[model samples]
Target chain A: MKEKIHIIKIGGSLIDDTELLDQFLDQFSGIKGKKILVHGGGKLATTLADKLGIEQKMVNGRRITDKDTLDIVSMVYAGSINKNIVAKLQQKKCKAIGFSGADANLIKAKKREHAEIDFGFVGDIEKKSINKKLISKLMKLELVPVFSAITHDKKGNLFNTNADTIASVIAQALSAKYDVELLYCFDKEGVLEDVDNPQSLIKTISEEEFSNLKNEGKLHKGILPKLENALSAVKNNVNKVFLIKETQLKNHIENHHEGTEIC
Target chain B: MKEKIHIIKIGGSLIDDTELLDQFLDQFSGIKGKKILVHGGGKLATTLADKLGIEQKMVNGRRITDKDTLDIVSMVYAGSINKNIVAKLQQKKCKAIGFSGADANLIKAKKREHAEIDFGFVGDIEKKSINKKLISKLMKLELVPVFSAITHDKKGNLFNTNADTIASVIAQALSAKYDVELLYCFDKEGVLEDVDNPQSLIKTISEEEFSNLKNEGKLHKGILPKLENALSAVKNNVNKVFLIKETQLKNHIENHHEGTEIC
Candidate 1:
């Protein structure tokens, strides 16, 4: 059987948790497979911007990346966040290469302009142009490719992309014979049915049910996009989509516990 | 008198020196002026890439930014390095806002394919479309702009730019009635008379002498580019250029330092 391809999306919240992040890294170091790690640094970016007195403006929870905001986001996401993960993985003896979308033209994208609201510096992946060959080369050498959601265009202009979405796209693109699993690892257990209750973890949710919950206002904003991204991955040929707590990796991988499993 | 505009380029080498970085931040915190900071992260970027077993190749000392390398560079320069500086400044009570080229469309550039060598993702300033208004607004709020040398195109694509060059460009652009002082801060005392001798700091050098030294092979690679950038700023109306040791900030500002003062 071909090596199992797992694309894990680690959110900024979980990445910032030193204890949890170290634990995840330890578990990841022992794992033997072709793995791709995509990460987000939203909290870090926003907090730094706020502390610097740079106004934080978001359109629908997503940062409205003007030139100034893009600068801050790039620094936080690609610089601090990416390196921290690489360093942690290295400490665990994992051969991991951290990168942004512009590297090797790994993920080419077009800046999405929606009506009057232009998502400045935001990129939608040029799915066909993604150089999966780069990932394949690295994976063959047993190296984990850690990616930040920053891409470039044909002309070599960079764009800030959504990490979860990028992971899904990458998983789909790299889908060969092995089952493609996308793990959206965040701080919480999984997609919670109640925002205030930690015990209200949804064990499983179908696409229809997820949409219904979203419409009914039961699904919170944080997990809604994650769910949509997970569904998109499933539709795009990923075998399974898992939303699990980052710290519960062993439980989820070995015992399959305490998270929403999406198909 | 209008607060003198100072453009300071803090290099990765100095940042690596913890003591120097801390000292510079403390000094910068007390400075009263409209200041813009441009930073380089070559050392950190290369270190991380090497640890990951990624063979780093450079064209003219600048990293040959392929897709993967660009990602690494973005992460190191914009993400990790940027935040560390901002955090340190914040710790010192300096209101510092970190930014990359994509923010506020502040710096726009065209990819230079000079002499058939495709300098992958490297950009030259567009000159016309720099978002001075956005910078002006930020300065009005007394927020010191810490810039990463990344640029965007008219179509919202990001590119890696030379921090020294970007600093020069920004200095010229932000110049009003007061002369813009461009200071390239690094670990070295200044441009040396002899590369082998640390004590041979050149106190002053004319444009012609600087060029002569380059031709004579006394100046090579990285420093050449930095000098070129400094000269470009001088030619473009920036008032002065100083190659000063980051640790000697107080002496340099007080006009008593042993640094290479270029005019």
Candidate 2:
């Protein structure tokens, strides 16, 4: 039997709230066994960009990561947010180390190619991109790696990668050596039948169901990418995958069914 | 005999110039054997702070790192500068990994305890503060560790640390396991007798000579802390210490005497 390792990803909303982040980390630190954290950039980057008067570049209504935006995201995600989370986890007695994908070449990415739109600095990654050997070695040393949504091409460029996809690919890569459980922690109570109703939770989501819901326009714009990433993880042989509430981490870890599991 | 390692420190001015920094990193990559790089925050932090209208807090001519300033430095130094350097080094085929003190609790620190002034997030570290064992393990993996001048209190706060002091203490800590040569690479041709003449470079300076130079008030203000840190490393068990020109890195490594040695 392989060792169990939980790969939990948190979105930006929780990180922007200091008190909530601390509480979440407190619970995260209490989890037993091996774990890795992946975090998204919060509103801080957008806020800083706005303050600096760096206009958001959009092509076909899709957000584009220009040089200035990439710089802002790199600083916010890989620097401020990543270090702060590591510090807080350290205080909770978790052996957390922070990283961008460029660190030790943990993850190498390629610039996203498009038909008509240039995504600027956006990167696309696959399971092969992850340096799983070194990651396992780090885990063997009992170190919890906290990763930021920043990746690099070996050709001297840092790109803005999606945090959800980062978590998924890492899980896919590491599943070869560990019993990897990937969790996507968000603001809601799993996939909701009604976005506002906590009681209307979907206990499990399959790829067909997800596609149907997405096609029916029942899913919100934000949860679309997350569910896609989650499905990708399940398809890639990740042991288990879930979409859970940020506040339900402890409960989910204990009862093993607090949120919607992806099958 | 212990295995050899070169611990090099670079200043902010070098980092501020992109072209010069790339050239220096190229030279750095050409060097043989185990090595580590510690870099200072360049003008970007101050530039960002100024743009954001965050006033520089000073007391008795010493800068204070308040909440706002700390946030900016953490973002610029640990995020933008460190990752960019790592990416560039990777491009040069150097296996570089970037870090802050908080990463893996690599260097735990204490808040600066001053009698009259509050330095806010400034942290002070010692020889014992370095996690040398883990660092050695990292070196064994053939990864070059690149550090940013950002540390944490372990109690949940990231602090602005002096990059020179960080290099000195790390060298001191690792000297027990490696034959360490600590180098401070900057713009000038080592310590100069006449600030304007590169030919006026002092070949070496002992403690007595350094004190005499200080008493004569001949040394410039900026080099004072750097010289002090270099001396401290020599006084500790660091095998050797030098202040060399940034451009002379390759020459110094080859010829082994291009800088002003500290005895």
Candidate 3:
């Protein structure tokens, strides 16, 4: 049996709140064993973009990354957010190193080539791109790796990528070497039966039950992608997956407390 | 005998031009043995700050890092500039990693304490703060380190620091294990005795001659601090320090070419 490694994706919304981030860091520090934290962009990037008069390109409500947008996102994601989180983790006694995928060629990506749309500098990560050897080396040194939503094509261009995708790709890639658990931690406690009711949390879901929830129109819209990411990890040989509450991270680590585990 | 390591500092002014930077990187990649590359900020940060309406804070003509300015600087230095350099180096086939000081607590700092000034986010790197073992490991793998001028206080505060100071400090710290050569490359080829005559270059300056030049007030005004930094590195036991032209990087590396070497 391989030693377990947790790849946790921290959602954008939880990062901007100082008090909550502090508490989250405090809890995250208690997680004993190897882990990695992947973080998404917060509202600050958009705000900076607006102030700079950079037009936001949205296609079907999804943001398109133009060259200018890529620069802003890189600044926000890899710069302030990544460094701040590393500092906070250090303060919490969790030694961590921040990385933009370009660093050490940790992730090599190909620019998104779509037939209809040009998503200027957005990249879809390539296969076998994760530097698992380097990562494993760092993990052995007991340093947590914190990654920003930035990647690079080895040819010489930076790309803005989705943090959750990066997390999932990394988990799947590492599954061969370690028993990996992919966790999507956000504000919600778990997958709720009723979207509005926190008390209507579902503790676990298998593929058969997940399809039933999808067919019945009972699954939360925001959680659809998260579940898909989790299911993909499971199918890819990751040992387990979870959709857990950020506030409950401490209990989840110490007590193996319940979250919406997907098998 | 200590192994040789070149800790080269690239001046900010040389970074913006693509053709020049590309050529410089190609030459840099040709360098043999262990190395590191530390870069300073360029006009992008100031331009971004101007666009964002963040006032530049200056104390007696020296830039002071207030919080808003620190945010912008981090975005420029650690974000686009750092990653862009990393990507370019990778394109040159020199595997490199970029860092802000907070990464892995590699360079812990303390917020500047002063009676006369409140440079909000400025930090002076603490002694014994360099992660020599981690850096040695990376060097052993032939991965060059590229550092941005941001250090954390370990208590969660990210700081804006002088890139030259960072280079000096790191060089001094690493001198015990390496015959370190600290290079500061800028636009000018070397220090010229007659400001208008390139042929009047001062190829070398000893400590005594340095004081004579200082007394004569013959050095260029802008180069004063750089020379001071080089002198301090020499004082701290760095094997050698050089101020050479970015375009002449290849010659300086392969031919034992002439530059303003401060001994």
Candidate 4:
């Protein structure tokens, strides 16, 4: 049996709230085995961008990461937020090390290519993009790597990558060596049948059910990418994948079930 | 015989200039064997702060690193400048990994304690503060570490630290296992007898001579701390210490001398 490793990804809402983030990290530090925390950019980047008067660039309704925005996100995501989290984890006796994909060439990304839209500094990755060998070696050194949603192309460029995709790809890449469990921790309890109903939690979601829900137009717009990423992980041999509430981490780890499990 | 390792530190002026920084990195990548790079924040931090309207606070002619300033510097130093350098170095085929001191608890610091002045988020470090064992393990993986001058207290606060002192102490700590050469690269030719004349570079300066220079008030204010750090490294058994012009790195490495060697 392979050693179990939990790869938990936290979204912006949890990262934006200090009290909640602190409580979550306290639980995260108490986990018994190896773990990796991947985090999304919160309102901090947008807030900083607004403060600096850098206008948001968009094309075809997709947010574009321009040079100025890339700089801001890199500073906020890879620098301030990443380091602060690492420091807090260290305070909790977790040997957390922070990283941007640019560090150690851990994740090499391809600039997103589209026939119509130029996404500026956006990067897209697959499982092959992760430098899993070095990551495994670092993990062997008992360091918990906390990654920011920033990646790089080997040819000297940093890009704004989707944190969900980062988590999915990393889980996929490490599946051969570990009993990888990928968790997407968010503000919501789980994938709800109704957007406004907290009690409408779906316990398990198969890709077929996910498709059926999508075809029925029941899933919200925000959850599309996350579900896609989770399904991708399950398809790619990840042992288990789930979308859970941020506050349920300790309970989930202890009880073996929480929010929506992706199969 | 212990393996030789070069610990090169670059200051703000070099980091601020793109072309010069590029040229220097090219030379830096050409360096053979084990090496580490410690970099200072350039005008970018202050520039960002200015644009954001954060007022600079100083007490008794010493700059104070309050919370806002600390946030700015952490982002600019550990985030923007550090990651950019690592990416550029990666472009040059150097396996560069970027870090702030908080990563892996590499350099734990104590908040600066001043008798009357509150230094806010500034941190002070010594030789023992560096996590030398893990750094050695990392170096063994053939990854070149590029550090930004941001540290943490291990109690959860990130602090603005002196890059020169960081370099000095790291060199001091690692000297036990490696034949360490500490280099402080700046815009200057070396420690000059006459600040205005580059030709007046002192070939070498003993601690006594340094004190004499200080007593005679010949040394400029900016170079004082750098010199003190250099002396500290030499005193602590670091194999070689020098103050060299940034562009002269390759030349100095090849010829075994190009700057003011501190003895």
State which candidate has the highest lDDT: 4
Q: Name every residue pair that clashes in candidate 4.
A: none
Cα lDDT tens digits for candidate 1, A177-207: 4578789888788888886787998888888
Model 3 Cα lDDT, one tens digit per residue, A1-263: 79988898997778989889889888888888999999998999989999999999987676799889999999999998999899999998998999999999999999999887788899897338798888888788788999999999999999998888898889989988998878889989899998788999999999999999999999978888888878877888888788899888878877775679998
lDDT of 3 by residue, B159-254 (tens): 988788888889998998999998988888788788788888999988888888989999878788788888888998999899898888888887
Off by over 4 Å in 3: none
Which runs of model 2 end up more than 4 angstroms from their true locations? none
Quantify all predictions' global Cα lDDT against the true fold: 0.74, 0.95, 0.87, 0.96
TM-score of chain B of each: 0.91, 0.99, 0.95, 0.99
Pitting candidate 1 against candidate 3, the one with the higher lDDT is: 3
Chain B global fold similarity (TM-score) for predicted model 4 against the true chain B: 0.99
- Which lDDT tens digits does candidate 2 get at residues A69-114? 9999999999999999999999899999999999999999999999
Each prediction's DockQ? Answer: 0.09, 0.92, 0.89, 0.91
Cα misplacement distance, residue A92 of candidate 4 (Å): 0.4
Better of 1 and 2 by TM-score: 2
Runs in model 4 deviating more than 4 A are none
Candidate No. with top DockQ: 2
Task: Choose 1 or 2, whichever is better by lDDT.
Answer: 2
Which docking category, incorrect, acceptable, medium or high, applies to candidate 4? high
Counted clashes in each candidate structure = 26, 0, 0, 0
In candidate 2, what are the lDDT values of residues B142-232, reduced to their tens digit? 9999999999989999999999999999999999999999999999999998889999999999999999999999899888999999999
